[model samples]
Target: MSGVYLIGAGATPVAEHYGRSLADLASEATRAAFAGLPEFAAHRVGALYVANALGDRLAAQGHLGAYLSAAVGLRGVPAVRVEAAGASGGVAIQQAVQAIAAGAAEIVAVLGAEKVTDQLDDAVEAALALASDAETEALHGLTLTAQWAMLMRRYMHEHGYGPEAFAPFPVNAHANAAKNPLALYRFPINADKYRKAALVASPLNMLDCSSVADGAACVVLASERVAREVAAEGVPLVRLAGVAVATDTPALALRADPLDLAAARASAHIALGRAHLGLSDVDVFELTDPHGIAAALALEAMGYYEPGAAPRHAADGAITPTGRTPIATAGGYKARGDVAGASGVYQIVELLRQLRGEAGPTQVDGARVALAQCLGGVGATAATCVLVAER
Candidate 1:
């Protein structure tokens, strides 16, 4: 398999907009993504890969592959729709890797898009149902939030980690979003606001949840040979070092621990091992943070903390953008809005910006190696990727 490089990426300015479907937003941003790059105007795009979680449910934009292909004017190329629940985008990239490695394609365009605001109520309910085991968990009347709430209680009882330890997670994301021009929730959320916010499910508050949003992002990938032929010096080329996916038990209650993200930890270990890098070698981190607790659990499962101590690390400001390790500098799903399948790809897009030193105000200084992790439905499924700047 040939090495691949992420040559370009573009995202719609994150905002709350009405009556827009995910495909529409994706097409709009993808067109702009290619149009803005004069250097790649003549380059041949061999395939189009789209990561969409909600296909016909929220906006009824069915047949995303054909729709986006025609919309982006990349006719006659193979178009693939990638979906792994919330980790759809990351999995889409994983497919792109195999395509490149197998000589099936040299250039792939990956897009992650979601329209959650059109039918906010249904979207919320549908997203929650993703936490279920479908045959079992869904029949048992479980929503993602409900599962997390129960898991949170279990973690609290098992490890003495309370709601207070998780408070800083969302608060930090909101504060970080305040600095991001494209973040949906730009206002600051302090400890006072955290204490007073209405509880959606006991420990999880209204502020703890992500807002409904409609947006899209796209990235262009080319073979290593093509990157050397086209890229400029200042524009750092990020090579996809490794990618891995793992799935745990479907039912949260049936897993090793409802609060533990076994799949995420396993996927990260595999990806980092393949990349020949360790936890300490990653310079930037971006996670699919649908809730504050999800972020804490992923960090702990990924060896960032010792089991129940993730909350304490987050509370001590160890996970903030300016802290020792930054997770979700673009505010994650908590501030960036959870767009289901799009969340994982969006995290990769943001990390590309950080690696290229093009993140503007949110840039992580001196970042070289970057890791992005996305968990699907209470850690039942997960995808992890490690990328490094091409020297």
Candidate 2:
């Protein structure tokens, strides 16, 4: 297999693009991705992988691969939409890497775009519910937030904590997001505000939940030969290094431990092993969690923190911008605005910025090796990638 490098990365500011269509958002991101790189052109892209989870339900459209490829001027390119619920974008990236590694394409474009705010809140909630198990979860009115809330309650009960234990995650996210101009909620928040925030579900307040917004993120991935040809002097080359994806039981009720993100652990460990690196070698992580509790659960599940310690770890400022395990550096879903299916792509874009030393205030100092993981529907599907910056 050939090596794959991220040749270019770009994203639109996460927000409620009230008038923009899904294709428009995707096109803007695609153009920005290729903006400073003259070596690759839109027409020259060998394949296009589009990730849109609610285009059909929210946008009232389908066949996003062709629709978006043409919208972005990649006419006639072999394009297909990748849907793995919230993991769509990360899975799209995984597929793009495989294509380049298998010599199926020299350069492939991965675009993760989602439009949710265009519809009503209730409508969006129902659409998001579809990501959960239809017969067991969604059909019984188990919304995604409710699923996470259940996990939060169980974690608190098991760990002997109150509802406020998860505040630090979002507080840190908002603080870091204040420096991210592209982030939606750029203001820093405090525990007081978290305490006053309205409840989305019992134990999960609005502040704890990620904003449902509309945005797109895109990346241009190239083969090792193409990357060498496009290399700019004095700039570090960011390689994908290793990637692995895994899935768990779709229904949360079937899991041995509802809080155990089994797929997340498997994917991250497998990818890290492939890169021949240990957990300590990672400088940063871009983990996809819908809220603070999800973030806490993800950290523990991925082995970043011991079980029942992630909340306290965050509370103690261990997950800050300069801490031992910095996460959600680009504001994450809380501050960056969760564009659902496109979040995985956003994670990659943010990681690329960190690797390039251009993350501004959210930059993890001296970050070299990073992990980016995205989960689909209450941790059912997990996609993990190890990125290495070669100086």
Q: Which ranges of candidate 2 are over 4 A from the true structure?
A: 39-41, 232-235
- lDDT of each model, Cα atoms only? 0.79, 0.89
lDDT, candidate 1, 1-391, per-residue tens: 3387787787776776686656568877787566534455325788888888776677677788888877777778789788777888888888887777777777888888877666767556766586568887776667777777787778888988667667888888887788877778888888778878898877778878776577888887778766666565345678988889999986876875577789999999999998889999988898877677888888888998888887887888887766777887888889977777777777877888789877776677888999999877778778999989876
Look at candidate 2 and tell me the lDDT of residue 356: 91
Write candidate 2's Cα lDDT for 234-279 as tens digits.
3357999889899998899999988899999999998898888888
Candidate 1 wrongly placed segments (more than 4 Å)? 35-43, 232-234
Error at 204, model 2, angstroms? 0.5
The true-versus-predicted C-alpha distance at residue 323 of model 2, in Å, is 0.3
- Model 2 Cα shift for residue 232 (angstroms): 4.1
